[model samples]
Target: MKPNLSLRVSQHLALTPQLQQSIRLLQLSTLELAQEVEQMLDENPFLELSSDDGAPEPDPQAPADATYSEATNADQISAGDENDVETPAVDTPDDWEGDGSMDAAVEDGEWGGDGTVRSGSGADEDEADAADLARSHESLTDYLHRQALSLRLSELDRAALRFLIESLNDDGYLEDTLESLAVGLAGADDAEQLDELVHRFTVALGLLQSLEPTGVGARDLAECLTLQLHAMNLHEEGDPAVVEAALRICRQPLDLLAKRDLRRLSQLCATGEEDTRQAMALIARLEPRPGRRFADVERNAIVPDVIVRKTGRGAQQSFSVQLNPDVMPRLRVHDIYASALRGGRGGEGHQALQARLQEARWFIKNIQQRFDTILRVSRAIVERQKNFFVHGELAMRPMVLREIADELGLHESTISRVTTAKYMATPQGTFELKYFFGSGLGTETGGNASSTAVRALIKQFVAAEDARKPLSDNQIAEMLKEQGIECARRTVAKYREALKIAPANLRKAL
Candidate 1:
């Protein structure tokens, strides 16, 4: 049977190019969004950065409802205008007589002035400098090379040392064995040359270990600790008996030290219980990671997208939620260019330029929508978790993406996009927007307790636990049961691990 074509009418959802861009922009973190804006500014001639003086003054006659009151800065775009691309009106060429260039228009105040974004204030600059210090930090290799310059060594010894220095991992561990390293350096299968290279590497390794970072060039955690212990012994930094015990303990299996098996460690190290305890404590004080300080810390830096401030007092207490001005990119359509494109006579390139103008408008509109959606979602979170704002994470209530999505008349996916990489600066601390949402646990009162709150409670119990008798996961679960929250031992253990807390056996002190 052959199929025949028939007239049909069907309706299905579709994503326009502008809608796709909006969705893409919504999911980006503040840093990513800034980079995207910079790229668009470079690619599209119609787009430019709005200067501080370029922002339009608020009209005294305009109704209060027309502007967004939550924003501290007047340049903030209103969230209400979803359909309009609120661009400043461009003047016709007849209105101003000049060279007809963007520079001339900016000087005459016909469009945004200078198109130069101002640098952040002094406090912001200081914070930025601190952040830059993390990004521009000296690496472990560079640090070692700087110290190497002072060493009075033969050229061959220096070459060997440099080769060894380059072989170190980020943790300052020499993962490859001396044999393998020598084989790599020898670049030949000759036994005599391989043996000579191995000897050279051994000498270089000894010289490298004696460098200032103390434990650099270690092959394993045990070796790293032993090196630090030796350094401490040389400096007379600790008790002789304790240092010796610690050195002995480092030689034994590390699992015993990790489990805090005081009896086993004392037996192995041939030291008294008190001396073993002191040794373990001393081991804990030593730096296991020689390259930790030099590791790039810039990856951990966070730039929050929203700011929440506490307002009023007592019964009138409230919180003001606003988009972070610092993270918002000041962008606008190049008014003179747009006006010229509109006023010019028809030509082959005119349509392409018009398309670019429309793109710029759509970009501005999409950017506004992105921030607007974030603000709405953030406000919804602040409203629901107000108790958390006042009383900390322990007071956080159970929440889900659907709740905010329903409240804002947006899809759950949109809510997820808004929360994913976006951060909020609150009275408690800066938290990712998704941090406010967590699964719930049932309570005896027929209510739900947020998993976040449960984790916070578990953290509190652990903090206040007796050092001699730390609480176990089972005990913690029982305590939660007594508090009317039904949490199992495994759940408590999972939360404890998520908080990076050690287990009871490991936490126990002598």
Candidate 2:
């Protein structure tokens, strides 16, 4: 076996560097893609952002009309790779335009037949600036510290309060017990020192809870609610009897309140049914998360990769999908650098510089391909789920990655990558691209109902149900059955939970 030698021929797929880059760029969210572009621009001398005025001036060192010579080279390189993985073509239909500008009329449900889509430029600009300003807001800790400055306290008390403020979680709840906090602070096993630290923490805790947001230093939900109730009582914000009843209810197990167990709450709070109901209602108005407003807005901000606008009216209704110009990076090969490289042939480090130029070209090509694929996929989604845009989530049709993948001559994994982390802005609201694809449930008409639509229906039923006697999952299921959808009670419950709706028992009013 050691001396054996034979000729063999085998074929296996391999992702080329450009192909890998294309795949990677396709999957990245708008923010991530922008970061990648920034990195490429920094590393490659040949790569630069294209001008808003259109193509750069023609390079004198190069042939006439060769301002974007690298673009042609890129096309040639990509075209010559016959055996490489299929990349989405940039040639799109006239209807499926990628020109960043959108028409104002399209948003008003009227297509002027120019095939152009434009949002309210002035309004969007102001809104974007406001959003950017909003995202730059201070963190919860910073906000608390700002309020702390107005306090007149000894250094020790101030330090303790600062420590407690920093210890609070994003939700404004102090997750650690004062004993543990004191132990951590004392950093010793001495009992007396620990007690002194705990006392300071307790004093600090009271002061911290009295902050502007209220309930900032609470250790648990009950404590947070109690603190807010006490504040309300002190301020005479609500009826005295109701506030007192709420305080009493907060002392009992929270599960009773969550379940809306009026009898149990009345028994535990020692209040009349009417008073308990009012107390529960009062508690509902209180903010459970005091620091939620201060949470980092930038982290949660979603920059959609595609924008879909409603076009036409009545019987001629249509959707115009376009790549979000804001998210798409305007990238190109540096004309001066590429011209210098082209003219100074066989110079020192010529090969390395040429490789970088090629890389820059590939980067631009891949970026173009990425947006093209996204546009294609988005158009397919809009075509299939057009009803969803017009009629909302209830009219969402059952769809899968394979359908779009097949229609676009792409692999299912590519479709998945396109959808993940990528969002689309539609009249219905911005949603992830994956939101359009959902598993189907069988219906009596031998058709399929999207699970998303089913979830939407469940939400509607819950919304419309009588508060005194909310519809149970079984009742929801029965209602769906009557509506030609064959959904199980468990499925309804699952969808309800997914929608974050409470159970019937919990949803019931006193």
Candidate 3:
């Protein structure tokens, strides 16, 4: 067989560096972006804070020029206008003025008296940045060691305490018993020493319980609440009656307290309804998680991708398709250093420096392109899912990457990258970009409903069910069928699980 060469024209998708960078930047959470920016700033000397670009100055001499300057920005300058063309100016306030020269204006402000250096002065105070709560809390072991320092315990005892602290879970509860702890510590120098260590640990246990969250370091709920009551008991030293009342409440069965049975609790405490109520109220106030108070709270600051506000026009809306600002690196190429390298004034490393300079520019450019791509994709999403904005998930039409890609005149994979990990803020709530896409479930009529809407409907049915006889998955499926949903019982169960809900048996009332 002869191998024949033929020319064919076809369409294909490619993953360019710019496209890859765009995808990476699009999905990054707010905190992730800040970290990325910091990394870029360190690697690329070219980048600087947007605020460091320069501060606004009052210039009476160029009032008209100031107005023009105000209008000029990164976005405006980048977009060309054929009819209204602009040339690089000789004298300007910027570090790299419009002049063709690569050399930056000196510290003398030869360009203008308003030469604001893009360094330390008035940088953008990383506003609307992701919450960095993870950094705030001290580790359990570190806290235990610090507490141990105040106690008059032996070195072996301190070590035992450290081990116990290490054994404590994230909720700050010690998981092992004294015997188990002793067994664990037996690997040390002496067995007798381990016994002594256990004794010291008992004292440390009290200290841990007393630390915070009132009830933390407790092995169980009963112990946890009891520990908190004990703390409150200690604070009521002057009032003997109050102290006695607290002790009685602690000694009683915890099931009564958990159920919030006030009348029975008053009788059990052997106090008046008011004092018992106060004690019950006090018990309620004590935190179950002593360590959780100190534990780092993972803060997920939701930034809405779309901002819809009511306007004078008939339901006017605007979508601010912003990249998580934190992720975009604040960069500006070092003109002075770059020029020196280009001019061959620098040594062998000049080549490397030039490469770094180019990389920095490329990164920034890619980032800008990523934001633009996200904006375009998000706008397309809003356009297609406009009904969702007016109504809600119930109104959300079935969408897929192909649909969006076709609309945007881009490849399906490009649409995928835009949607993946990216989120958009809507009037309903902030949702991942992918939330808009779902397979269509046909109704009895020609119309279709999203899987998300069906799940929501199922949730509503379950919420309104009789608690004594909770609606089973099969029952829910039947109900959906009645409503013309045509869903299977297993599908109902799957959606229930996805919603993090248990089966009807588990959800049943006592």
Candidate 4:
């Protein structure tokens, strides 16, 4: 075997550190990006937030020819693909990424400040404050403990109750047998002691079950429902007969209730079909996961990357895209540090400071490029999905990453990076950028319809459907066919399931 050296031209892509940072920043969600910025601010003295007032003002200390100015240099932009890992040769002036600066200026304005493309700011501070409360919700045990304080229980009983409360899972289920908890307190050395411990546990269990949620400390689903029924009975809630019937139903195998077998349930409860239906309805209103609300149900702390707003009214009505100032970290280089480094008066620290200064420039420029790419992509999306904005998801046209990438003169991967974890707030709702792109479905007129539109249509059909005779997937497919869309029964089923709609049998009202 011999090794030969030959001259061959080969092309390769390298992910430089700056390019990698750009990609990372692009993919981070609004909240995550804010978190990353805070971390960077703490770690790097070079990076600091630009004014919250919306525009990156040129540093007063900077010379007229400073490389790190308000706007990036056109020549440098042409040289750095900003994305070819900075390949300017393939970039066009019309492309968003070409100049490495945002074409549209993002002003700090309220969400509903301007109609079709723009929506009201649903993420106001009040909602955020409420969400913050939810974010810091107390554990179920702590909640139960507070409720226990109002009761006049002995110290031993209160301790046992607290222990029981702690033992309950986040879902409020007590999975372990009383014998297990008893053994922990009363060793296995003596059966009599264990029996006494079990008796005390039995009493504690009753008090624990009496908690506000009604079903807390329930051994199983059946017992949980029974405990709730007894509480309802004590409070004289619901029709006496209906409450009685629900208790009887709960006492039976829970699987029968879950299957929604009205026939079997009625037969087992020895009640008529109508009575069984009423009983099922009452049971349906009960909360299965009692502690779910108390659990740290982290509400998505979303701040949109792009905001679409309505500009004009009537015939002149148009939507414009802009970066959200809230999500876009107003970052600028630290003035004092940059000036000292530039003056060359900060001796021995000049080299390290210079590197940090350069890094700061790259970070700010990359961030600027990120927003510009996002704004351009958003504009193209708005242009393509204009009908969707006007008429809702039903009018959303077919779109793919390739279409946007081709239109913007960007690689599909770059488009993907820009779309991932990035959200845009529009009149309809705040949606991830990827939500706007969907594969096409064939139409009767040899055209194409967005799968999103098809799903929207299916949702409408299901919502308007009769409860007594719910539409099946096959029927839905036939309905789509009537509307000039070619969809299969299985495809309809898939979409139906995606919308979290139950099957026809399950959807049918008793």
Candidate 5:
């Protein structure tokens, strides 16, 4: 064996901590960025919000102009070779602690490397105050526990019921059966105890089924439906004959009900089609996932990063894309703290303070960069999608991330980060940044059409369709073909489903 040595030259990129943070900030939605701003303010003492209470009240337009400049600067900085594979700056720490990536974010800004940030002035006008919707919701588990508190039972019975309550899934279906639960409890206690636990669970099962949801702790879909029916039996809407008919229909195959096979259902229930139809209507009103409504679902606000408003009238009309002031945090280094940090103080504490000061400056700069990238991308998108703004979605052309990346001299991934979670408000209303990018379909004129445009066409056709004789997917495809779209029936069906339109039979009036 022999070993040979040779000198080789190659280039690769390493993402700095600050660059990574900038990328993350770029992708975060408006609400998330605000939360990040609040967190940084709390964690970094050097960082403080810019305001006009004690400070001198400046011109309202000052922050807007300042924001423009900051965004421009960031765009200028990152408008480099975006395709550099080794551009490892996209991998920075999420927070400003430890290595402090914020330092790496803004190289030449107001901070000027010495890390002294001049406090900013007033807020931007476009930064509308976000509508706060905070409500304390009672979770499914908590709701069950509260009801359990009112029940009178022995300790063992309550324990077993509580265990069963805990075992129920989010949809209020019991994932584990009493037999299985008893088998698992067998190892924990003697046979007599196991028998007692089984008996208590059996009794608890009936009581749990009687919860307000009417289907809280059932074993399967059939059981869940049966529990609801049982509850409805005691209600004012309850019809004894209807309940009897429904019970007979439910006891048969589930597949029959799903298909809505009216004649077959009537035959199976030994009733007329009219009776079967009424019984099925009762089932339709039943809540399948009773606990779903109580889930603590966090509803996010859609605050647009860019606002595109039309300027000029008639032939001179054009859209102007600018940053939304509400989302851009009016931030700077605390003037008092920055002045103190600038004074030549020497100590271990002094170095730590200096680091914190730098972090604050970096945080401000990175946030600026994030908005800058967003603005640049949005401007480009507006430029490409002007037809869409003027003529509706049918005028949209095929676009990909790479096209914007090439035009802006940014990496494809950087473009993706800018588009994700970001939104634009325009004359046609607000839409996601990624919504404009769609695959091309060949046109009869040797041009390409946006899949988005095709979807829009499908939506229009369905909206105008006659309910008495709804257009099937095949008919829709034919209509598209007449317009030189060359659409297949399957494609029309897919677009129809994506738009949440039902099938022809489903759309037909009964």
Candidate 6:
């Protein structure tokens, strides 16, 4: 048999750089995207925060404008694409008059619409502003450097300390190997001096964990909690029941402890039910992941992509949906740079330069496509779940990716991508774009309730239940049936778990 040499033509989809970026940006949580953007800004000269324009102008009463810009900037920057992404324009407050101001404001707020931010000025305002600024947090590295200065160390030792501090991750763990630390510092001096410098890191590590939130500089979850417990003076003498229980709990899988298995835990700790419960309670207070706090606090604030407002006509009500403008990034490539590249001014690196330019352009274009897709998906949600806007989660109808995809005349995968990690702020609360899409639970009467609505209803039942006999998953399922939402006890348990609610026994009162 001869190998075929004849060419046969067929088309296949290729993952372009821009498309890849869109997929990545879509899936990234707001915090991850912010970090990625910060890193990108460092690597790309052309890419910068929209506010790198200037220190934001001072405003005393311009809450509306400030809110507007913040929301708009978040939308654009967070969307992560440059081309074809249309930022919905903000409506000036001037258009909204008298009682309309607050009504408009509430409407905007409900839908996460762009509006001016409230400002502070004057002596009183300055004091208020200072109080507000006090909440601003320092980076982990900055805090470590400040703490390190108080330690009495030689110049060489201090240098090593700084290196080790820098190497500590957000959780306060020494992620870098000592060998790598030595290599990194070797450039400053000879191998002998570098080894001495690296040896000094142990002292720094001990001190780093000793800082606020303890256990931050720990090597892992065990060390982090242990360090924190030690710092808190919670770790005590041998057979100190609380300390032993805490240690035992931490040593095992955190999930088992999270379940608060009173019986199993009592057996493990060689204690009675009361002692086991107490130990479990104490262990619950310990931070499982110390770094999560830093990552969460530093995360970018939510900027909704769409807003829906209720407008009434006579006895009838409807929703007015608007896309948020604040998160949009208004960017354009430098004309001079583009022209220079076209004129062959890049010389030897022209190919690389052109490639980068193409990437940037593609990035911008992909962002535009992302916005277009989001808009279509969001609109579909608004249309199908209009009842939800009018009457809250209780009125939310069953919806899924296929329903939206069919409505928008797009693929389910496309709908899935658009919904991934995207958020919408509503009167109900801030929810993932996907939250509005839920499977249906068929009712006895041949109708269906959204699984989301069922979850919400279940939560309401649990929250309002008697603590002495807190509603179990089985009980909750029964309650849902009373409300005409037919669901099983296991399904109730699943939803309860998803809401981070403990089991019936654990949720019960003392």
- Which candidate achieves the best lDDT against the true structure? 1
Q: What C-alpha lDDT values do all the predictions have?
A: 0.78, 0.76, 0.61, 0.74, 0.72, 0.61
What TM-score does model 4 achieve against the real structure?
0.79
* 492: Cα error in model 6, Å: 3.0
Q: List where candidate 1 sits over 4 angstroms from the true fold.
A: 1-3, 7-10, 56-139, 159-163, 177-200, 270-274, 343-348
Instruction: Assess candidate 5 and give its TM-score to the true structure.
Output: 0.71
lDDT of 2 by residue, 75-107 (tens): 422221222223322332244222211111112
Q: How displaced is residue 126 in candidate 4, in Å?
A: 9.3
Clash counts per candidate, in order, are: 0, 4, 10, 8, 11, 30
Lowest summed lDDT window (length 10), candidate 4: 110-119
Q: Per TM-score, what order, best first?
A: 2, 1, 4, 5, 3, 6
**Residue 25's C-alpha lDDT in candidate 3?**
67
All candidates: CA RMSD in angstroms? Answer: 8.5, 9.0, 11.0, 7.8, 7.7, 12.6
Q: Poorest 10 consecutive residues of model 2 by lDDT? A: 108-117
Per-residue alpha-carbon lDDT of candidate 6 for residues 308-368, written as tens digits (9 for 90 to 100)? 5555665766554445544544433344555566668646688787666555544444444
Across 1-510, the per-residue lDDT of candidate 1 in tens digits comes to 999999998755544465567678888988899899989999999888876664534323224443332232233332322222233222223433211111112111222211222222212334454367686889899999999999999898899999999999998999999999888877767999999888888999999999969899999999999999999989999899999999999999999888889999888878999999999999999999999988867767787887777878999888777666678777766767766766798887998887776677567656765766777678889889989999998899999988988776667888888899899888898899999999999999999999999999999999999999999999999999999999999999999999999999888887
lDDT of 5 at 296: 48
Question: What is the Cα-based lDDT of residue 10 in candidate 2?
Answer: 73
Best by TM-score: 2
lDDT of 4 by residue, 171-248 (tens): 899999999998887788899989877877788899988887889898888888888888889999999899989998
Error of 1 at 80 (Å): 17
